[model samples]
Target: MKVGTKEAAELLRICTQRVRQLLKEGRIKGAEKGDRFWEIPLFDGKPEVKEGRRGPKPNWKKRVSKAISRICVNQHLIRSNSKHGTNKPVIRVESRGIIRYFHSLEINGSCKVVYRPDKPLSCGAKLWLEVASDVMLTAFVYS
Candidate 1:
């Protein structure tokens, strides 16, 4: 079965002008039969809607590798002494690992330190490291 421009529009629940626009954009496969007529071929005995283009897929392996590299290089160990608190020191790290781009660090134990990065990191950026205590260690990394 086939459908004219108007019929196709009605069947597709779109306006007649939209049908013409789709034809102009080469979205829907159809051909002009005359000055004001068009023929849309049927697929599986029915008119089929055109599919849209999809964006590129993400590179998971590259992201994982970059995260591992950041961790292995000890990029999260950078820090400075706190000016306001004489006993406590401020810690910082480039974003990376399970925490990509920007992330908050929470260390539980002796120091009980909480650290937030100065800037957000990229999809596979390095992370800053901060420690709160000297006993057992618990770290939380979020993407």
Candidate 2:
């Protein structure tokens, strides 16, 4: 007795595509390619499925380690800068990406800072603006 790929798939409890793949891979015997379908021997047992390596590949660890190292280096630079003083440039231009420049400002005087970009920011920009300012005791007493 012979059955088409669809009927074979139903008997094997798998998809028709898998049945066709098994036939092509010669996992099952007596499978003849018909006009538009495959004729598989109904007497043959279900083909065995070999277990393959699952989940993400092992090479991801190397890439992840590189990323973590980069982050650590950036953190070290920030810590060293803070210990020395805020002498670093407030704005730094990059060669690529949407954020053309990186801006980090620190104000320690009785003044206000404003950021007015020429074009509207679409993404990759974080604006940390505080509207309210605390008045010092001396400034309030003098006023």
* lDDT (0 to 1) per candidate: 0.43, 0.41
Single out the weakest 10-residue window by summed lDDT for candidate 2.
Answer: 64-73
Candidate 1 residue spans exceeding 4 A from truth: 30-32, 53-143
Scored by Cα lDDT, where does model 2 land?
A: 0.41
Residue 139 error, candidate 1, Å = 78
- Positional deviation of 44 in candidate 2, in angstroms? 6.8
Question: Per model, how many backbone clashes are there?
Answer: 17, 0
Q: Taking the tens digit of each residue's C-alpha lDDT, what string does model 2 give over 90-136?
A: 33222112122233433333433334365323332233232212211
Task: Give the Cα RMSD of candidate 2.
Answer: 25.1
lDDT of 1 at 123: 28
Cα lDDT tens digits, model 1, 30-51, are 5546666778875433345555
What does candidate 2 score on TM?
Answer: 0.30
